[model samples]
Target: MRPGIHPASRPVVFRDRAAGTLFLIPSTATASKTIEWEDGNTYPLIDVEISSASHPFSTGTARVVDAAGRIERFERRYGRRPAPSRG
Candidate 1:
């Protein structure tokens, strides 16, 4: 790894506002805000809208799309394509 040419990697706090969770991880991202962690240390705070804690897949609350319904709608609007001829 080259030194001085890369962005500085330091401890940053990612706050999942939806889940009220804070994760301390190394990042190159910078933030104007700061937060005091449980360990009595201050770190740059980055607020995120979504994370694994609040994601639909992680929470098992994802909605399954109806592929059949979409196909039916497309056929109704554009009609079905004819089968390809064998060469």
Candidate 2:
């Protein structure tokens, strides 16, 4: 709540290029381009590679990793650790 200490937050347009979506929200991020929004106002434009709209997990297209197989393969290649002796 301190004045002139924190960066001022203003409306910024975040464009999700992958999802082809445009989001207008408050942000402190910088952008060189500007665009006219639906409200007939121009806001700072920040293009992002990924967002919740186009992310694998958010879109329910994420694939489950084969963790167990990977662990086994790593152990085989590096040699498994010896079991600890009971004191």
Candidate 3:
């Protein structure tokens, strides 16, 4: 319970440019622009390039790397090392 130690957090509108989505959340970030939300209130407007709505992992559009296949291919190309003999 210190006084003025933490940054002030307020409701700010974060707009995802790629997905064209808007989110109203409390943030310590600042913005020069302003916007009127659906609730008929004006809040700070923060434009973002991407968000969970447009991210590949969230949208299930990300490619899953085949590690095993890659290892097999690498072994096939550059032969596997022989087992070391115990002294």
Which regions in candidate 3 have their CA more than 4 angstroms from the true location? 71-87
Q: Which pairs of residues have clashing backbones in candidate 2? A: none
Give a tens-digit lDDT track for model 1, residues 4-86: 89999999999999999899999999999999999999999999999998999999999999999999999999999999999
Better of 2 and 3 by lDDT: 3
Better of 1 and 2 by lDDT: 1
* Model 1, position 61: C-alpha lDDT score: 97
Winner on TM-score (1 vs 3): 3
lDDT score for candidate 2 against the true structure? 0.96
- Error in Å for residue 53 of model 2: 0.8
TM-score of each: 0.73, 0.74, 0.76
Deviation of model 3 at 84, angstroms:
13
lDDT of each: 0.97, 0.96, 0.97
> Per-residue lDDT for 7-68 in model 2, tens only?
98999999999999999999999999999999999999999999999999999999999999
Angstrom error at residue 66, model 1 = 2.9
Query: So what's the TM-score on candidate 3?
Result: 0.76
The alpha-carbon lDDT assigned to residue 4 of candidate 3 equals 89
